[model samples]
Target: MRSLRRTASTLALLGLLAIAGCGSGSGSDASTAAGGAEGVPAVLNFSAPLVGGGEFSGAAMAGRPVAFWFWAPT
Candidate 1:
């Protein structure tokens, strides 16, 4: 009976997660203000200071593909 209860609870949790995952797919006001979903920019132009020193420019790699990897010790 205890195992049956646990299985039922697990199934219930999975169903809840599945329902939550299916979002309304509607853009918020802030997203629309920032050029909406369809208005994605072709070129990313921004710069940020590196941790070790030096600035990274997104504009420099405008025509090329770029990939980023973020890691946290904790």
Candidate 2:
């Protein structure tokens, strides 16, 4: 009886570990960026040519959530 209980407990633990291991890693990697764990860079400065006829500055977008997108052809 004791052996059965121990085996059941071990199986439950292994099951939990397996599920955890398969969980999403994106959240962790996103937070730990090049700047630091918070992933935000201080005094961030970026300028890019606008499609119409202007430039964009990262400083102007400070304090707002920003996302960068890229496309690559295979």
Model 2 spans > 4 angstroms off: 27-74
- Could you tell me the TM-score of candidate 2? 0.36
lDDT of 2: 0.61
Scored by CA lDDT, what does every candidate get?
0.60, 0.61
User: 1-74 in candidate 1: lDDT tens per residue?
Assistant: 99999999999999998997798864332221144234333334456777787988655654354666545447
TM-score of each candidate structure, all chains considered together: 0.35, 0.36
Q: What is the C-alpha lDDT profile of model 2 across 1-74, one tens digit per residue?
A: 99999999999999998997797764333222254324344434556776676987655655565666533448
lDDT accuracy of residue 55 in candidate 1: 89
lDDT of 2 at 74: 80
Clash pairs for candidate 1: none
Q: Which candidate leads in TM-score?
A: 2
Residue-pair clashes, model 1: 0
